[model samples]
Target: MSKEIRKFCHGAAVAAMVGLTALSASAEVSLNVATVDAAGTLRNLAGNRLHTLLREQDAGVQVRHIEGPVLGNAAQVRDQVAEGSVDIIGTDIAWAAPYSNFLKATSFSFVFRDQEHLAGVLDSAMMAELIDEIAAEQGVRILGAAVLPSRAFFTKVTPQRAADFEGLKIRSPQLDNWLESYKAIGANPTPVNWNEVFLALQTGLVDGAHGLPVDVQPNNWHKAAPNVTDLEDMFGVHVWMINETRWSGMSSADQATLVAAIDEVDAWMTATAEAESLSTIASLLDQGGGVFITHNAAKREAVAALAGADKVVAFPEDEREAMRNKALAAGKALEGQATWWAPGVLDELQSVR
Candidate 1:
């Protein structure tokens, strides 16, 4: 929704909620939510689902999902929430990492074994304590986190082996850990804004883009970079953050209601992400846009024996491990630089089953 419409609706809600609260003090609570993705995408769906679930649990809770670029990018809207102008924001964990060392640790590659492992760590009491720390220090609290599919390269030229990626410019966000990890894998990691990635790929500003199928398919980046090399290295986590002050001022009952709604939506995202990714690839293939590449030795050899095998080659598993190690090392190194980092947090995460 546009900011003008949101303001009008919020103003209307205030008067209606005032009457409801007069009847019962805890009768209503209103939340102004922000998200960077456009309406109807998975990210937006999660926010809209939260609104539905919240209203079902408590009829008087008001939620306005302000879709972007109505507000700005993820970083800009996150500032809005921290400043208390917006109640909640849906953003990537990586975008929020600069504010919280614990979040920075989670943003690195190979930190979790897989989707189930990531989910377990996020749902644990340890993570809850870390989030509380963010609220206490950074003014924003992560309510819940959900996984997206594993990320890899969507390249103009299919990389037949790990060596093929060497010295090639790969587009990624300008983040220390991500840049360092890609460097370890031998790619000359290039920083590019997400919105500008299509132009970057089309103009050969970067030889390939790094992201998931869902991310590339919607933007038709696959049309520019038709080869998808599924290194299956790391997954993306979408986090819901709320302003700590706003949360603290809310009635305990209202806080519980919002948390319950987020919990359900997190579950839904985790359950559906994998299927959505597969469906995305199927559609990409049907549209003559994607050529899936795998790293399994047998599959690689089998595809290589075919007529156009170069389009379906593999990235060495050893290279993927090297990237993972570099990311873990980078995450560990943060403890010395950031005073708020807990020494054993990385160990604790790895220890989770």
Candidate 2:
């Protein structure tokens, strides 16, 4: 969480605490809101925002915030939500892919043009159908989703061309799509748990890691591998979901309140992400500890906008196009092998404006 959000959520929590305490004895709804990320992360802040909203919206409703991995990791917490052990959770949409493989499509790098494109598909009828299917099949209801910081390549050495990535070891989660994304670029994708990425990089266990600047900064991985390639290839979706049983048990008005609260959280998340993206890059450059590289024109423009274009290393245009072509081909091929998605689902997502 940024200072701005931390301050706002802190004040909101204080005010909400007073309001909820006044009605503590008579509160009607008690929700166990959980998130796996640490206190300063976007997902954690979303959980805080939800708690604050529920309290301010209804004095009769009480929300218990579990802000860290006290319960478990992302997959474990998501499972808890389905099992009703956790009332609500904020985590990666990809963690829910085991219940519905259609969600895997969203994890493919370069699959969506940008945040607006992803958000459009999230709100589209197709996504609604997918969510409803999950609710009925896996007993989880997705309330809303926010775009996570885009995953970029943070390496020890900057690659100036497509072939420069050949045989490079990139640490990644074991997700099939994500690993395949790195493999598609001719890079050797190694499945390393996120918690181990920093050590893995430090010890030369991997040549690079694919992740967000926010993650790199907080974990201080930049100190280990200071070269960053901002492919902006893929972005993760941080979803707010509730146990289907819990959702169904709620009064219709309470359900509406939950959804409305999440909508505001989502809006705040989108705005925060946009501003944070630029500031993170600026911070990285200001520290003079990392070399940031990108071939994307828009990303270059963004660096220029921040007046840090001089600090960004440019990847060759031809190499970028070649890499893009290969990545697209690989994404399409992976979709063909994954039979879980409804026929034509990928097409529908791509067609979304």
Report the number of the highest-lDDT candidate. 2
State candidate 1's TM-score.
0.81
Candidate 1 ranges beyond 4 A from true positions: 1-27, 56-58, 296-319, 322-335, 338-348
Residue-pair clashes per candidate, as listed? 0, 1
Error of 2 at 13 (Å): 25
* Residue-level lDDT for 275 in candidate 1: 67
By how many angstroms RMSD does model 2 differ from the true structure?
Answer: 8.2
On residues 1-353, what C-alpha lDDT tens digit does candidate 1 reach at each position?
Answer: 22211111011011211212222336577899887775556777788888778777665566888865587777788889999988899877787777654556555656777777776655543454455556778898777677777776788777766577788898878777677557756788999877788899999999998876776666677888887777656677888888988777776556656666776787787677676765565555555455667665654454344424443556667766766676567666665564335665666667768
Instruction: Encode model 2's per-residue lDDT on 1-353: one tens digit a residue.
Output: 22111111011111211212221233387889898777776777778887888788764456788977788777788889999999988777777667666677677766677777876666543455455566788998777777776777778887898998899999977677667778888899998866678899999999988776765566666778877787767886777778988776665555555666777888788778767876776676666466678877777778767746566788877887788788877766655454444445555556767
Tell me the whole-model lDDT of each prediction, alpha carbons only: 0.68, 0.71
The candidate that achieves the highest TM-score relative to the unseen native structure: 2
